[model samples]
Target: MTAADLPEIKILIDATELFPSSMLGEMVQQFLSGNEAKEIWLVLTNPQSVGVAYVAPEKLTDGTFNLLLIAVHPKQQGKGSGTQLIAEVENRLKELGARILLVETSGLEGFELTRRFYLKNGYELEGRIRDFYQDGDDKVIFRKVLT
Candidate 1:
């Protein structure tokens, strides 16, 4: 995605409860500026973007990549769009010599589906940080090793 895609990408991000709208601009800027570790991918259906995935390769690590942010439009949530986008990200990361891909999500009731999605997609539970996000919301990390 290009700079012109930021607004739509922000909309997709906003539709989900994962991130705050205020940080969208800064995040987009960071991706656009060619940060060595960061990469953003957009899923477009026609002229409108329906999904976004923000990923980063771990610096000074042995082929590790992080799936930083991923969101699909609310209207398209259960229709395989998210899986397709994730598959694309994994393919690209593998091409870049990534051996392990990690993803983290909130450990709250609201995020159960998100966690399940990762598990369903072949990711294994790696670890969790207690009260990482707040007093109750923990951070659950998942890892997938590329063959």
Candidate 2:
């Protein structure tokens, strides 16, 4: 996606309960200005509405890419959108010299579905960061090595 995509993508973000922050707006602006992936993939349902994945390059100790965020609308969940988004992200990352993709998710009880979704998308359980999310929430880190 390009700069033209942002104004509409903001609408999709607004329709969701998960992303109610104006920081996202700022992030997208920065992303468009070159702080993010060379290309963005979207499950676009309208001009300014979409489910998105914000990718960023990273040099892991092993050197790879990190999919910073893989977000879908609550209304757009359970329709293979997450899997599709991962596939696109991986493909784009590979094209950009990425050899692996690392992702992180919260392990809150309420996010069990989020955890499983990553596993289902071919990410392996790598490790965990205790209390990474808060007093009672740990962060689960997962990774998929691209071929």
Candidate 3:
């Protein structure tokens, strides 16, 4: 996505309850400015964005990338938008010779569906960090190997 789409993307982020980022605009701008470390992908329904995926290559690692965030607007959830976004991201990464795509998500009760989404998309549960996010909330990690 380009800088012009930042506003709509931010709205998707907000609506999805993803972690708020005060620097999203600047971050996207830097990516547009040749920050190869970051890439933002969007799924739009004509004028409005319905899904987004923000990813970054893992530093000092060959063919390793992290899916920092992926979300589908509530209204767009339950549709194939998310799976399509995942397929797009994976296809693009495979073209880049990426071997592994990692995703991290909260392990809270509220995030059960989110975790399941990743699993359903061919990402295997790799590990989990106890009390990583807080006293009780954990950080669950999943991995998808792309040949």
Least accurate stretch of 10 residues (summed lDDT) in model 1? 36-45
RMSD of each: 1.8, 2.6, 1.6
Candidate 1, residue 33: lDDT: 77
- The models' CA-based lDDT, in order, is 0.84, 0.72, 0.84
Please give the range of 10 consecutive residues that has the lowest summed lDDT in model 3. 37-46
Candidate 1, residues 69-89, lDDT tens digits: the string is: 888899988999889989999
Model 2 spans > 4 angstroms off: 34-48, 59-62
Q: How close is candidate 2 to the true structure, as a TM-score?
A: 0.82
Tell me how candidate 3 scores on lDDT.
0.84
Worst 10 residues of 2 by lDDT: 39-48
TM-score for each prediction?
Answer: 0.90, 0.82, 0.92
The superposed Cα distance between candidate 1 and the true structure at residue 111, in angstroms, equals 0.5
Where is model 1 more than 4 Å wrong at Cα?
Answer: 35-38
RMSD of 1: 1.8
Error of 2 at 113 (Å): 0.8
| Backbone clashes in model 3, listed as residue pairs | none
